[model samples]
Target: MGDDAPVVERVVESQLAAFNRQALDEFMECYAESVELRIDGVVAASGKEALREIYARQFSVAPVRADVVLRIRQAEWIADHELIEGAAGGPTMSVLALYRVRDGLIDQVQFFGQRVTE
Candidate 1:
């Protein structure tokens, strides 16, 4: 683990906590101004304003939450295997989210998710 590992973990953890709480402002605080959010290898949103718009819509529509089932950290990167419930009124999902932290803020995130059919 590098010295930045803890910083990466802390920033990611904070983002997770904010998301789970449905606190969009707090969640946004953990991200950089020029952040990128990707889903299934596609760029879903770029920059803080776009991120806010996306999440704001989601937050107003449904009660979504994510719980991390497993986490792996390496230097400035953290990967989380998460169980997401109540996501846009859809089935539960298992998602693998990879996050990259830079200068104490999460600058990029990639999420790959599948419907949990159990």
Candidate 2:
């Protein structure tokens, strides 16, 4: 682990807490202004404005929360295996997210997810 490992972990943890609380502003605080969000290698949202728009819509529709099942950290990167629930009445989702932290903020995130089926 590098010197910034704790910083990286704290940032991610804060973001997760903010997300679970639906605190958009607090959530955004953990992200960089030029943040990029990717879903399955495809860029979904770029910049804070876009992120706000996307998350706001989701927050308005339903209460969504993600529980981290596993986490791996190395230097400035953090990987999380998450189980997400309460997404607009849809089935729970199992998601793997890789976050890249820069200057104590998350500059990029790549997500891979699948709906859980019985």
Taken over the whole model, the C-alpha lDDT of each candidate is: 0.94, 0.95
Model 2 Cα RMSD, 1 decimal: 0.8
As a whole number from 0 to 100, the lDDT of residue 11 in candidate 1 is 93
Candidate 1 structure quality by residue, lDDT tens digits, 37-64: 9999999999999999999998898989
Which regions in candidate 2 have their CA more than 4 angstroms from the true location?
none
Model 1 TM-score, 2 decimals: 0.96
Clashing pairs in 2: none
Model 1 misplaced regions, further than 4 Å: none
Cα shift from native, residue 65, model 2 (Å)? 0.9
- Structural RMSD, model 1: 0.9
Error of 2 at 64 (Å): 0.8
TM-score each candidate.
Answer: 0.96, 0.97
Residue 16 accuracy (lDDT) in model 1: 93
Error of 1 at 82 (Å): 0.4
